[model samples]
Target chain A: MNIFARIGYAVMTVLAQLGRLALFTGKALAAIVSPPIYFRLILTQMMRIGYFSLPVVGLTAFFMGGVLALQIYLGGNRFGAEAIVPQVVVLGITRELGPVIAGLMIAGRVAAAIAAEIGTMKVTEQIDALTTLATNPIKYLVAPRIVAAVISMPILTLIGDSIGVLGGYIVSVYSLDFNGSAYLKNTADFLHSDDVTSGLIKAAVFGFIVALMGCYNGFHSKGGAQGVGNATTYAVVSSSILILAADYVLTALLFHK
Target chain B: MSTPKIQLIGVKKRFGSKVVLDGVDLTIEPSSSLVIIGGSGTGKSVTIKSILGIIRPDEGTILVDGEDITHINGAARDRVMRKFGMLFQGAALFDSLPVWENVAFGLIQGRGMNRAKARDIAIQKLAKVGLTEDVAFLSPSELSGGMQKRVGLARAIAADPEIIFFDEPTTGLDPIMADIINDLIVSTVKDVGATALSITHDMTSARKISDKIAMLYGGKIIWQGPTAAIDSSGNPYVDQFIHGKAEGPIKMAVKA
Candidate 1:
């Protein structure tokens, strides 16, 4: 084939692959309409993908909140307006830093794990075995992860948001020598409902993206050990990249003010 | 004569310019084992996958018990699949689940049986594969390779499926364990009276478990006959693959 033809063929091949993936996603959604909801399986996935993700998300959020408080204090001090530190720290964590950090951490933890688990299953033919047993794999496997991620991420983000604000609160009360009531009041006054709502919304989207990327890379992984390893790496890297890009887009839309 | 349990006519599958299956036809009888033997990349796995609807053929009609089931979708396709049990080559047991939960996966998840009931059946199936009740609670990662294969066998038979597919079941195991697995395959298939389709390069597994042996080459089943007659099949491809000869009609892509 000519070079032009080869390029065209490559593009077409990519499109065709996308079409196949779209078809798989549709089949998974269709299976969701069937009976045998597998509620127990969903709950089990929720525990694994969501509930278990707390400690990592909490630690990351706490540290981030403290760091944000310190940075804002330093930057505001340069302007002789260090009092803005509390407002800036609370607003930054609730609006951007909190959900994005929590989402990225969960993505690193959950997405890579899900991808590796499911990818290994794919290569070994466990997914095929499920099909042979009359179990729709999308419902039995992918759907639960997706649902759990969407549901659990918001809750996890809220907790992270609270802990992160508290981290900022601790930093401000002790190091910045701000009165506790004033710090709390400044935080309360400066942070809007939209800021928190936007973060939670971003968390849900990030969770969806993370789970989808992980499951997608995993479900389609070929070869043996090398294929699964590649899938796990792809899941983490892709999820982190997508999380950051999405944060920018969402911030622009949700907080144009 | 019994009706064919599974039949594929003029099946074809191609990946881009490369063809994986070229006009393949196969018929599997009920309550018997048919093992497809081929060197790697000859499409034995692809054939089984096509039968299971894991990979759709470009042109073919796959009939299960005289039903043209090539294009059915959603709930109907799943209903057709309920009759099958598969013991994958690698034993594909879920690492996240305990051994019993893996075996009873279909029983509870697919059939909506309560956990208590599924656990009972799970333990029973595990026992039949030479495992005790204590082994049921361990993760699949904790088991030895041989034990893993047996657990795979247990899971395959757990639902009492009418059909079973084994894809390279003996790959990556010691010869002794391979023989053990071969024995287990024969006895279990006989016990359940389930129709079996297996793909293997291992001549020992092919010889031990197959009542009928089919050789796949160039994307077609070039020779098929009784297992006892594979020695004198008279086909160069079959002879070469069976004996593991380096120089034969079936050439490998050897690099310098």
Candidate 2:
């Protein structure tokens, strides 16, 4: 094929994929609001996507906050503003790092899992089986995950923000020889409720993206095991990229003023 | 004559450049077993899926009980789908759910039956398929291929559907086990008075279970007759497929 033809083909493929993803998102959202909501399934998914994700999100947030504090201390020392460590860490964690890091981590963990599970179900005809049994696959499978993820992510981000701030406090008090009480006071003074809420809003959007990508890839998966494996990879890659891209867009929208 | 239980008129489907079903038409009478025999990629499954509304035909009309069901959605689609119970080629049991739940899935999820009531009916259906009560609580993964097929059969009959579709019901079973399943399918389908539509490349299973058989080749139903008349189909493709002949007009697409 010529270069022009190849470029055209690529554009068409990307457009087709985008259309499919949009359609899937619309259907999943519709299923979420419709009747016969599977509260049991949603609760089960919350335990899996939110409660179980606490450890990884907590650990990553703690280390990230500690590192951020150390870097800010070094940078601030040069400007004779060493006391800015608590303020900067709190602002960063509550506004950006906490939600973005938690979203990316869950994208890797939960998104990959949902894709592989649903993709396997597709290959094995279990999805078709659901259809045969008079159950809509979208309502039965996709909606629960999307609903649970949307509800779970903000809560996970909130917990992660707390842990991250505590990590910064630990580092400021011990490693940097700062006063613990003063550091807490500075963090509390600098952090606004708006900052925390904005991060949570971003978290909810990221959650939807992660679950949507997973379901879209998995539902379209064909062939066999190899196809399912590819879906899992695509789910993680697309969701992680989308999470980052959405973070930029959301950050601009939420914190622009 | 009375209207047939299921009808497909000029059903056509294509995946990319390859045409899977090319203007295929067939009619199935009520409470009769009809098996579609074909090669591996001969659109046998596609034909069944089209009728079941799993894969909509690009161009066609599918009718169930004289009602045009070619385009319906939501609750109407669910109501149409409730008439069907399918036994997938690989059983397709939910690995997460135990055998009894797999059987009761439709009753509880689709019809909103109480769980305890659905479980009782599930056990009863399992027994009808020669499966004991002990197997009900076991996960589908714990069962062998034959046992899984039995569970799938039980699930198909659980709701006492008006129409039952068996997609390669005995694809991977030993001859004895396959024959047993064939017998179970025939008897269970008879017991429920369901109109059975099965697709299989397994000629033995087809011959054993079906009262009438249709041959699908090159994306069309080339020949259809009663099971006893299949030997005299006179069509080369049907002859080649039924007798398992390699040297015939229907050449196997073996890549060099």
Each model's DockQ score: 0.76, 0.94
lDDT by residue for model 2 (B1-256), tens: 8889999999999999888899999999999999999888889999988887889889989999999998888889999999999999999999989999999999999999999999999999999999999999999999999999999999998999999999999998999999999999999999999999999999999999999999998899999999999999888889989999988888665531
Q: Cα miss at B201, model 2 (Å)?
A: 1.2
Q: Candidate 2: DockQ?
A: 0.94
Best by lDDT: 2
Docking class of 2: high
Report chain B TM per candidate.
Answer: 0.97, 0.98
Distance from true position, residue A142, model 1, in Å?
A: 1.3
Best by DockQ: 2
True interface contacts retained by model 1: 0.90
Task: State the displacement of the C-alpha of residue B237, model 2, in Å, after optimal TM-score superposition.
Answer: 2.2
Cα deviation of B175, candidate 1, in Å: 4.1
For model 2, how does the per-residue alpha-carbon lDDT over A1-257 read when each residue is reduced to its tens digit? 89999999999999998898889889998999998899989999999999999999999999999999999999999989999999999999989999999999999999999999999999999999999999999999999999999999999999999999999999989999999999999889888899999999999999999999999999999889999999999999999999999999999988788
TM-score of chain A, model number 1: 0.92
Question: Where in model 1 is the C-alpha error above 4 Å?
Answer: A1-35
In the order shown, the candidates' Cα RMSDs to the true structure are: 2.7, 1.2
Per-residue lDDT value at B203 in model 1: 94
